[model samples]
Structures are given as structure tokens and as C-alpha cells.
Target: MVAGDRILMHLQGRSALVVGGTSGVGEATAERLVAEGCTVVITGRDVVKGRAAAQRIGAVFCRADVRDVDAMIAAVDTAADLGAMGVLVHCAGVGHAARTIGRDCAYSSAHSLDDFRETIDINLVGTFNAVRLAASAIARTDPDELGQRGAIVLTSSLAAMVGQTGQAAYAASKAGQLGLLLPLARDLSSKGIRVNAVVPGGMDTAIYGPEGPSEALRRAVSDAAIFPKRMGRPAEFASLVVELLRNDYINASAVELAAGTVQLPR
Candidate 1:
């Protein structure tokens, strides 16, 4: 078959599990997957919002926390039951902002260890949880004529490379995901499962809150972009995610979605 034909066949009738699909980039990705003719199951911790988002996008909702092993396995099983499990997109993560030292310069004013651990557990460990469980299901699926069984796309952040002040925990966790990409792709190669990551920068999403980010804050971030001079849209993020999952040769790659912007310390 021609390469174009192979790419077109990858999504149709396939089953995809998208972690953090209740909102933001994950919701957008799930919607795009459905439009591409894939059966998608989205997972989130909130039952109401999860169900609502699933309904809005014509996807199935599974209430599951990214950090929970059993919960993620159940989500994978749910997707597998929908069709041949072939896609896993992990978009779940938390952002934290706390400096290593407080302005008071007191020893007691150090960054909260609990907060750092929670961020790492949810962002880094949760990514592994989703990838490992989903890969197992995808590996079981019969490989295609091109020896491709499935694809996995992980959502990372440019902060991993250029974190601002007070973003140590968030940056470290996202960096961990990037660290996992290559080894994960290698380990899953024999099973015909590809792993890749998207490093987005300053996307306009709910992470900024329902009312959106303050004008000053938004302008500060947008000003750093080399061109377009605006934050990225979730749909733009979704587009890259779909491409990564469809393009079989993009394994282990970390594509930055920043508009030529290199974040600097505040």
C-alpha cells in the first residue's frame, strides 16, 4: 500500500483512549479523533464534566484519575472494548508555581515538599501509568500490513526546557515526560507501537481559568512569541496531536508548538 493510504487507514474504526479529555487540549483531541472515524474513550476525574465533554464530542467517558493504576487500566479496557485499541493520548497534568526559597529568606519558607511531590506524581507518574497500560492493550491488537499496531502521543510543555521562576515542580514533571519518550519508543518498537510528545507553550486553555488570564499576564506571555504574538489555540494543539498519531515515522520526537518563543525568567 502507498504511504498515504496507510496513514489514512490508521484512524478509521480504531479505538483511542485520551487521558484528561474532559477539557482543554484533551477535549479537542478527542473531538478530532471522533471526526476522523475513531471510537474514542475519554478519561477524567470529574464525572459530570467528563460525561458532558464526552457527550459534546460524541465520545465515551470513563471516570479515572491519571495517577491511579487500576483506574487507567479500566479506561484502557473500556477503549479496547469499543474497537481495536490503537491510540493513546495522555494530556493530563498539573501546573505548580512555588519558589525554592521564600522572599523572607527564612528556612521555614522553603517550597512545600508535598506540593512538589503531588505535581510529580500526577504529571510524570501519571503519564507512565497511561502509556504503559494503554500500550499493553495496543500491543495485543494485530499489526497492520505496515507492521504498525498503534501510536501514543504525550502532551508536554515548553516549560520543561525554559521554565520561569517558581515553576520548578511543573517544569521538572514535564521534563520527566520528555525523558521517557525515547526509551518508551524503543521499548515498544517490537510491538509496533510508537511514542511521541508535543511541547506546547502558553496555550489559551482553561488552565488560565474560566474567566481567562489577566490581560497583563496574557500580554507578557504573548509578547515573547516571535510571530503571531498570541497564545496558541487548543485546536492548534489538537491538530499536531492528530498528525503525530497518524504519522508512523514520528516516533520518539518532541515537537514544540511554541511560535519561536523561548521563555525567559520573570
Candidate 2:
């Protein structure tokens, strides 16, 4: 697609909802939507980040936690009140990594049960929950000239395919998103809606642990001699998402932005 080509969706006069748009790829995509003429609403748990992102992108901000069904529903309702939603971008996700056997999984010993379950709740179930709610609103909107009312672009990690030594919970959560796309595609086809996902490999995002690499995690990522050059930039991930949301043909699937680093285990 050339720069001269009109953006596939042309988003002008339409509304879009971007969850987790407070930072990284989500924030960037939201800005692009506004530039292309869409009224955008971005949600996140961070009020400061969310407000800053919205202000920067010329869009509105609605604080939300994807795991909170009520919060997501409110955000969706806000978007609908603004206008018919032309796009739904779910870029909200969090990462977790721990050697499965070593980490304390038991809540019985006064250890927190929050870690593993929270990852799944926020990254996997949250995506699923928000998509259905967004679809409900999108379905209400009449189709555009091409019979497309909206498209949903979800975020998953390369870990979805690459089950490293760690990331047991994170990988499982992300993979769930991939599993949902095809079925979601079929389910939403008649409603003029589409679902898809972006899988990013090792990124330069601040999600990196403060203490740096865990011994086991390091070996796992480097074991295949992949990503040896360096981690990928956040912008690289953002661009593909923009393309997917633009093209109506792209739906109910996932595109990996990882640099061929994640070879599926045989």
C-alpha cells in the first residue's frame, strides 16, 4: 500500500476505541487514527499516562482496566455515545515470566496468588471480554460502503507460539488469543466485523524486568541464536497493526512482527 493510497478505512467522521492506548503500540495507533480523521477514545489503568496519551493524540481518555468488565463496558459505551465505532484496537497486555516449578504457586503459605492468575485475567480473558463488548456496539453501527462496520486488532506476544523456559502463564494467555481469532472471525462475519491479532517478539518495551534477565529466561531466548542482533522497536510493531486495521481483508488471524525469532516447537 502506497502512502498516496487513501487509508483503507478512511476513518473520517467515525469513532474508534483503543484499549491500553496509554503507551507503546496502542498509543501510536490511536494517534494515527486521529490524523486519519477518526474520533478516538483510549483506555488504560494509568490516569496520567492515559490522559497524556489522549491529549497527545487529540483523542479522549477513559480510564479502564481490561480485566474489569464494567470498566471496559463503560469505555465501549462512551465510544458509542460519541458515534458509531469504526474500529476497535485492543493493545492492552502485560507480561509475566517465572520458572514453572520454582515459583511459589500456593496461596496457602501467605504467598500471593495474584501473579499467575492476574496475567491470564488481564492479557487473555480481558481481550476476550472487551472484544465481545466492542462487537456489540460495532454491530449496531451500519456498514460502510464496503459493508464493513469495524475491525478488532488484538495484541498477543511472540510467546504465544514460542513457549520459552519461562513465561508459562504469559505464553498460555497470549496463545489463547490466537486460538480465538478464527472462531471469532466466523462468529462475527455476518455482522460486518473482523478480528485479528499482532504478535510481537522481544521488544524494547519497559516491560523488561528491573533486575534484568532471569538465568533461565536468558538461555531460552538466546538458545535458538535468534534475536541476537537486538530487540525490536515498538514502532515496528505499531506499523503492522495500522496496516491490519486499515485493510478489511485482514481478519480473524494474526501477523507476527517478531523478527523470525520464534520458530514453533516441532
Candidate 3:
């Protein structure tokens, strides 16, 4: 049976919001949430893709950029309007590949400061923005019998812990997410909300490009895995996400979904 076939007891009739749900891991997670009986709202910057994804998964589409405060707030409001907001999965982020100093080692060949800033803004700052706003909406809802109000799951990358060459910006941004998980969970403890993160490695997603990763690149990354020797499926990642949301005991933690792969090739 697929993830959608199982309706999680805790999530039934609850509402959820998935940022960057137009495709990839976000889309997969949103689909699973619908299966678990959530009133789901998905947000993306592209209207056409966002609408199509939402329609495909039985979710509402909201066009919102993660970096924009007004847009994120509007997206949260849209989810809250459907029902009590109980789950938030932030999957919106970008990867950058530029060495601090180019191979030429010339001043003109240095990495662009603007690129680094953009990655941090969207991946790190945007995460905090969405979490804060969505947590507020969730806190407003009455807690469950267990005194649990809601749960949040953030998508962090394996690069955060073991960054490969040209991954400085991406790694730092994801690491920043780890920095937020524990503190945010602590801050929301009184409100009965939990925060956690999924650190995925080499997932099969569109981040590779429209054509996907080349065979050589795929094998290189897959070889890094300890078992099954392949990149992770988006559905597999989605499963962990729902599990984290369902298991109340698991909080303020970062779970790695890398098949025991701890290091990345340079």
C-alpha cells in the first residue's frame, strides 16, 4: 500500500501547509498529507506549476515566495482558513555551486556575494519566516488531548553535515536550519508544538535539472550510499516526513535519510 492509503490517526481532519510544493519532495509530502486526511495547502512561486501540482494531489495551491514575508503570511492564512493548522513542512530551497575562490584564484574569479546571500535568504531566513507564522496559527488552535498543538518538519540537506566541493553556500544554509530546529522546538514546547528536520542525501528530485542527473553523476552519488547503493526516492523521503509528524516523541531532532552514507565525494 502507498503512503496515501494509511490515514494517520493524529492527522485526520487537521490542516497542513507545504511550501515549495510545486514539485519534488514538497509535492510528494503534500500528496502524503492528503492521504493522511489533511486539508492541505501547497505554496510555490510558479502559479501554473503550483496549480497543476495541487490539482494532481487534491490540495489547494497558493502562489507564494518563501523569501517574501507577505506572501508566506498569506499562504499560512490560506491553510488556516481551511481548518486548524496542525502540520507545516518547509521544502522550499535552492542549491548553489561556486567555490569561494575560482580555479583561476584571481580577485575577479571569486564567488559572487549576491549568490550566497540569495541562498541564505531563501533557504534559512525563509524557513524561519514560514515556521514563525505557521506556528502562530497552530498555537491559536486548541491542543489535542495530549496537549500537542502541532508539528513542523523542515527539509535539510546532507550537505549541511558533509559538504562536497562547491557546496559552501548550500551547506551553510542547510546547517542554519539545524541550528533552528532545537531552539524552535524549545520555544514552542509551552505551546505543545514540536520541530524537527530531515537531512536527505542525494534524493531523486528535479534539483538535478529538467533532464535529471547524468548517469555518471548518478552513479557517483549512489556509490556513496552504504546499502541499496542508489539515490533515495522522493516517496521514501515523504514517508520519513509523515512519520516525524505522527510520532510525538520525536522532536528537536535531525534524522538523516542517507542509507548510512556519511561522506560525499569531492
Candidate 4:
């Protein structure tokens, strides 16, 4: 909040819509956005968890599935009723585990075609749908006093650049997200919208399943040779997304948070 500090958001009384705001990095970013003075509308398919996060942050919960275009548009409609959606953050994505061959079968599993398609549909296409829907609404709004037209923050993964033994589906989807930044930024340029993606490393949050945080992922991570020797925190991811929310200087790019640990093809 200091003048010299890096946070650049002018979020007071503005509105932001965070997709997949029920948990993990999504929930963390929603909290940070709220704290930065943006009235937040958080969405997810899990009504219970979504409502909980919204209530906890003093925001509203909108039921939405990013993979469904209608639902994504509905989320924007809900934002319209609230206020100008000055920021849009898409954090809904699936982290998958699949291998093409059996080289790592002892520590891997093959994905069915259904699983592969679902991963692609939800992770890549879902992100694109959310951005299109939200950016359309944001483009209609007048610029802020700062002549800014809002930012779209997409979430990618380090796996997009360097996949491990069993991350074919996940890596492909995340890499697709990385690939969309340039085109999306160009397409939305005339509208004054900025598009960016965050390629965060593994973070410590409960985004795995209904089972809560995964000890198995933690074990695998420890067993593996990560440079930092530990998982990243959700707050760290949120911090970067918050910076992206108000930054006009950062556009058409993806930021990585891997701590130089993801060079190998593992």
C-alpha cells in the first residue's frame, strides 16, 4: 500500500469477478482483491464452498461453470447487477495426471479419452470462455479515472513449460493457456483490455478433490527434485495476480513462479 510498494491497484469500490473462487489460488486471489477494496463476485460450481468463501470475504456468490459458455455469461450478468466488473480473473482449471507410455507406470496412470477431453475442455476452453465473457462486459464499461480498461488474469502452470513423468493432459491444457495470451491481447487491444497469464509452480492449497489437500502431491513433490525443496504458497500466487489486476504496463505475457526448479523434462 505504500507509494514505493509494488501493488498498483486502484480497486476501491470497483468490482471484480473471480472464477473458481471456492478454493485454492482462486479463493486466495478473491480475498486479496476484496482486501484491496474491490467489491468481489466469486463463482464456482460448488455452491456450499463458493458461498462460504463469498460470505467470508463479504462478497457475493454466483454459481457458474467456466466450461459452460452460458454459465460464464451468467456470471458476467451477475457482475453487471453488482457494479462495473473492473477486473476478471479465471482460476478454474484441472490439474491432471496422465502418461502416454508406461515408462513411469509405477508412479503414473493413463487417462481415458474422456479424461483427456474433460481436461482440455475445462482447463483451456473454459479459460478462454471466461475471458471472452468477462472482457466483453469490461469493454463496455468506461475507463477508470486512470484510463485503464480492466485486466484479465489467466492461470497457467509451470508444467506448461516442463512436464513431469505423468502430466500430458495437464501440461497440454496449461500450455494452451500460455499460447492464448498474445492472440487474446491483440484481439482485445482496440477495446483497451489487457490479457495476461500466470504460470505458477505447485502451491500449497487444497484444490485436488473433495478429499481436501493432497498429502500424496506433497509426498511426490518431496520425493521429486524441486529446486526450492517445498511447495509455493497460495498467497504468493495471489500477490502476483493482484499486481496484474491494476498493471497496464504488463500485457500479453505470462509470468512464471517456478523458482528456477522446472528446467528438466522429468
The model with the greater TM-score, 2 or 3, is 3
Task: Please state the error at residue 59 of candidate 4 in Å.
Answer: 1.5
Better of 1 and 4 by TM-score: 1
Off by over 4 Å in 4: 1-9, 102-110, 209-228, 263-266
Cα-based lDDT for every prediction: 0.92, 0.80, 0.91, 0.82
Q: Candidate 1: deviation at residue 161, Å?
A: 0.5
What tens digits encode model 4's per-residue C-alpha lDDT throughout 10-103? 6677789999887888899999988988888899998988888888878889898888778788888888678877789899987777567565
- Model 4: number of clashes? 0
**Candidate 2 error regions (>4 Å):** 1-7, 103-114, 209-228, 263-266
CA displacement after TM-score superposition, residue 19 of candidate 4 (Å): 0.5
Worst 10 residues of 2 by lDDT: 103-112
lDDT winner between candidates 1 and 4: 1
Highest-lDDT candidate: 1
Q: lDDT tens digits, residues 145-254, model 2?
A: 76778888988887887777667888889999999899998999898888889887766555666565455544544554354545556667767877887886787778
* Overall local distance difference test of candidate 2: 0.80
Local accuracy of candidate 1 as per-residue lDDT tens digits, 12-112: 99999999999999999999999999999999999999999998999999999988888898999999999999999999988889999999999889999
TM-score of 4: 0.88
Clashing pairs in 3: none
Model 1, clash count?
Answer: 0
Better of 3 and 4 by lDDT: 3
